[model samples]
Target: MIIQKEISLKPKSRGFHLITSEIYNHLPELKEIKTGIAHIFIKHTSASLTINENADPTVRSDMETYFNKLVPENATYFEHTLEGKDDMTSHIKNTIIGSSLIIPITNGKFNLGTWQGIYLCEHRNYGGTRKIIITILGER
Candidate 1:
């Protein structure tokens, strides 16, 4: 079976946010799947999706710091400055990190590691609601 839906996330500040519970809460259909794959694709170029340490808020902060350092805003080479200092860097971060994630599902739960969880990397200072397309493929 294949199920697909678009989920709109609440607005978030510029940071890495753990969204595992939110995803599960939005997709109740996942409970019906005995085994499957959940493919989440972000609709914007300024944000990204990834899986990482879920237990520590510091990890998220560190990730944000690292990305900011790695992709500094208003670089001399950037020409897309009309949007804002963060616009181009946000796109760069999104490209480097990624725009989607595919995870294994078993018994109606994500098969993530003990410390792993899904994250929504909001790269803009005022990134409005983000949209994600979730595609679940499985066999009951």
Candidate 2:
């Protein structure tokens, strides 16, 4: 059996937004199924999906800082400023980060590391809603 769901995320800043619970909620529907892997995919170009720390807020903050340093906005060489300085950089950030993620689900539970979590990294500067596609595959 295969299951799919969508989750919406509202990011305040241009950074990672944890979305484990939303993904977890979709897993319960697959309880009757024997066992399979859960694949979480994000449908967007300027944003990305990633698996990161869930324990500490500092981890997220640090990552946010890291992205800033890695892809600083308003670089002199950037000319695609029609949407603002962060436009091209945001797209670049997404390209490197990626657009989808896959996670394993065992015994009807997500097989994640102790501190691991699934996050939707919004590379955009402004806040908006992002959609995530969750797909669960298993045997009924």
Candidate 1 Cα errors over 4 Å, as ranges: none
lDDT of 1 by residue, 29-94 (tens): 898999999999999999999999999899999999999999988478999877899999999999
lDDT of 1 at 3: 96
Weakest 10 consecutive residues of candidate 1 by summed lDDT: 74-83
- List residue ranges in candidate 2 displaced over 4 A: none
Q: What is the lDDT of candidate 2?
A: 0.78
- Per-model TM values vs. the true structure: 0.98, 0.88
lDDT of each: 0.95, 0.78
Q: List the residue pairs that clash in candidate 2.
A: none
Candidate 2, residue 51: Cα displacement in angstroms equals 0.7
Backbone clashes (count) for model 2: 0
| TM-score of model number 2 | 0.88
What TM value does model 1 have? 0.98
